[model samples]
Target: MGFPVIRNRRLRGSAAVRNLVRETQLTVHDLIYPLFAVPGTGIKHEIPSMPGVFHLSLDLLDAELDEIVKLGIQGVLLFGVPEHKDETGTSACHDHGIVQEATRHIKKRYPQLLVIADTCLCQFTSHGHCGVVKFNDALQQAEVANDESLELLAETAVSQARAGADIIAPSNMMDGFVHAIRTALDEAGYTHVPIMSYSVKYASAFYGPFRDAAHSAPQFGDRRTYQMDPANAREALREAEADVIEGADFLMVKPALAYMDIIRTLKEHFDLPVVAYNVSAEYSMVKAAAANGWINEKSIVLEMLTGMKRAGADIILTYFAKDVARWLRDTE
Candidate 1:
């Protein structure tokens, strides 16, 4: 037990020794790739900000899904970009909605693939807010209608479930969203579908690339009212607790790099599978730096993913899923 006799370098002597004594492991099963779904056939448009990501139409999307299955990526988080948007985000809950149609297609073709529908109104709402918005005359700006948004959020969850989404991931951060959606899913005969709640989303600047990819930037205001403040860690626990009490099957912490502590906190306190969202801005930063030759992409990415695992994340929603999968394969 003394310092000289118990030198820790014994386990760090070689690669095989280090591997055998590794406390964390990152695998393909822990990754959930985020994909963009747009309307139109045979189209695969690249997102300008998020370099490697693309907006794939269903036809083009099918081919990618096939590759994803072959690569052994376990799940996908889908964000649909509709041709039209409205004040109420009607497209989000329509029978033939973009996400709904995409869900149906994946289930019919890749029935074994785990499809998690991004159940939020931002991409479909004309105002581009995550929920229904109403102009508040007193505040001199538009304000998201929280209670009213819950009704539509619940409807969206039910619609995605009906379309064969195995998991409904509600990322709006609206009050009572989990409970409302849980009730809606049960009433719609989708009790088997699980809810993956964005329980600890924060109002952070790290989502710019994602907003560009999803086309969900608010036209007028910010999401600070509903999303948690970035400075508060204790509040994340409160939010996670509420989602769990409301029947959320999984809890998520967004912008995972800067929030690893939050991920560990939630994992330590909750029994549900804690998920970490390796956000778009985080991805873009790495890509930008790597492109500039400031760092090594493979090593940094693997370390980042492994760090999340070491931080206690059971799953990670990341843009690096495919790259990480290929990298992991190369080492073996």
Candidate 2:
């Protein structure tokens, strides 16, 4: 009944004891790897900011998929950087776009792998804004046009669905995105495909490395206009309500490390599966610290991932998925 009588250390005593009493366990099945696809052959350029991640071309993507299969990673989130970008991000909806090509190839090679296409226009837009931008001449400012962006998002979603994308993740954070994309997918005979909405994504600084990996950084203004403000908690729930009402199959909280509270909030409030994106900046920091001998990379990474799982994340999209999978296998 007392602290001395009930020894908590008994559960934390050793590996076996700790394993038996572990409240959260992160497995390869719960991990989703993010892969960048560029338009080229035999290309696997390492992202400078993200140490172990690469910008893989379609030709080279299969080899990476081979290793992911071996590691038992069940899901992969793919982002495409096309050779051509435009005002409306036309490349994103192209019939033979980079992501479409890569998705077709990936599904051909690994039929069972859950390949998720990141449906957004930042990388494909020359202006590098998530949505359609219009200048407010009187106000001396540019604003993202939410309604116009929805049409483009719908086009992009349908195209990805056509290319064998098992899941379409709309990360643009535009209003009515889930509804538009869902309607488009259904009209295009992809009603079976699911939508993974980046329901509670915030305009956080933890996305620095991801912009580099996806080539999606804005040329001028930041994403504060479209992405949720980092200071708001109640707004995230409102966003979730909209997405859920629009029929989002999976709800996600981006930049998971600093927003575990938001993750828990969404998980508690929604019946849909909750996804936590351990964004690139978070991964890069751990890699940098581990490289400098400041921390044990394996132990820290496991702890961080387990923390997300404990916070009610059903799946985590991280750059460290491959490494974590290998670590999990070896430790077993």
Candidate 3:
């Protein structure tokens, strides 16, 4: 044989050696658990499409937080399912709203846990859109009113902060939304609370399960007018840039698996921490396949999470947070 001096197989010869050469590491601290808060006591209903995820009511939240704390997960992102919905999503701004109430309860019980409130009107809006809608008679269509939505978004952020949220995450992809929210937080004496902007959210089909969880499917048109197109990489950068300039403390890319390139791009372009949302659809697919015996759930999940970290995600907002954390603890 010719001189085969470079033996790449040497590093792959042993499991311990492979692990030693691992390029990325996934840990409990890199996770941000995403929880759904609904209205009721003693209620923990599993989302049908998302196997292990549940919509938890505040009455049972203390025990749930106890379990979460035991898993060594330090952060949580909350999405609220309010009892009521309206044209302007006024309920989202109420200090007594589901998210606000949940925030207060969670923070009071687990003062050390970092609570991030998802600031958006979709879950509270009657039309299930992210912003205020107006019918355009000239075009014979309904569209999100960008400027009108800014005030409501700001109000919602302030309410979340008052209710003890450590961070306000605005997923509503409205123009100038982050700037409005940052100013609102500061003016409301919550300058310490940070804004985690969903800066590169795409108008993706990977949000079906989330709609079921939050009851946020738009009754009319799609969100393409606001959300970025999956085909466009440059637009993602533009969106992230705008949010950064608008004072976003952290930037997030939604439906993380399909947007790993976007995540990498943002991490390379920005100095701030990059968050990736391993969205409900992504979770559901894995769960469904695992339940059907199509894949080894644990192994695949670890691989997927490690891939996200390798792609430069500083934080991962995932439905598998609790399970993954437990698995890590047990394995370790």
Candidate 4:
């Protein structure tokens, strides 16, 4: 029908009508908050690059966790900033590691809250790369040892599962990471825990604030060696396919705002749940614009997240999870 014959304005005539005809509805249940956990007695230092997001100590988590639970956020993706770093990231797999201890504590207190441990070695490695590094004699520079790194990743995943993590999210971008972690989890009798692989993480400029927040900036080289290039869309599918074949329960695309196409592509191709990480720089940009009175933070955030949902994201891991939950509650 033509526009005059079937006027679209009729449906848009009223807010109630618009609400009734809304194609996508974003809810608190679709949100997963990302949290930073550092080892200490009492500390809640906010990252300068990412405002309103704090690097919390284990003792300070009660208040944050309580607020999250009250706001009805389903889960949190946890990253640990250890005080110690080594070549192999041995601290990451220790029984009393920062993340392992934090996992145990959170599960003990809030059994209902899902804790997803980020299984990676960047923050625990002295070199600040995601994996073990070796001097490539031919290349005349250090390169990440992919196969050797898988053992540490597997150990980290099993350790997290043992510490009561509900999910293991590997963000290292290593080849066969999902397979290694899955095998390790099954062998350790943690087959129930699922792997949320960062299958299509791109080497983009959007991770500056996150590196500050997690204290995981590469000391010498960039992550382009392992992380996917942002220019190629077809490569995303192949990356996701590998993880799916390796038994990843959820496939994730990092820095979601610019890569909504990738999110929809994965959703269309994959049968599993597709998660979009609304990354640090995305959040920081909004905050910066809002601070200058250039935009309405609440409305912009709602619209942005809605757009993500409309793009076919089943779940979103975002720094704005708590705020979004509150906004939803207040409106209700």
The TM-score of candidate 4 is 0.98
Best by lDDT: 4
Ranking by lDDT: 4, 3, 1, 2
Off by over 4 Å in 1: 1-5
**Model 2: lDDT of residue 73:** 94
Regions more than 4 Å wrong, model 2: 1-5
TM per prediction: 0.98, 0.97, 0.97, 0.98
In Å, residue 253's CA in model 2 sits off its true spot by 0.4
lDDT of 3 by residue, 1-332 (tens): 79868978889978899888878889999999988999888899989888878899999787779989999999899999999999989999998999999999998899999999999999999999999999999999998999999999999999999999999999999999999999999998999999999999999999999999999999887899998889999999999999999999999999899999999999999999999999989999999999999999899888998899999999999989998998899877
Best-fitting candidate, scored by TM-score: 4
lDDT of 3: 0.93
Cα lDDT tens digits, model 1, 1-332, are 66566678889999999999999999999999998998998888889998889999998887889889999997899889999999999889998998999889988989999999999999999889998888889978788999999999998888888889999999999999999999999998998999999999999999999999999999887899899899999999999999999999999999799999999999999999999999999999999999999999999999999999999999999999999999888888
Residue 309 lDDT (model 1)? 96
- Count of residue pairs whose backbone atoms collide, per candidate: 0, 0, 0, 0
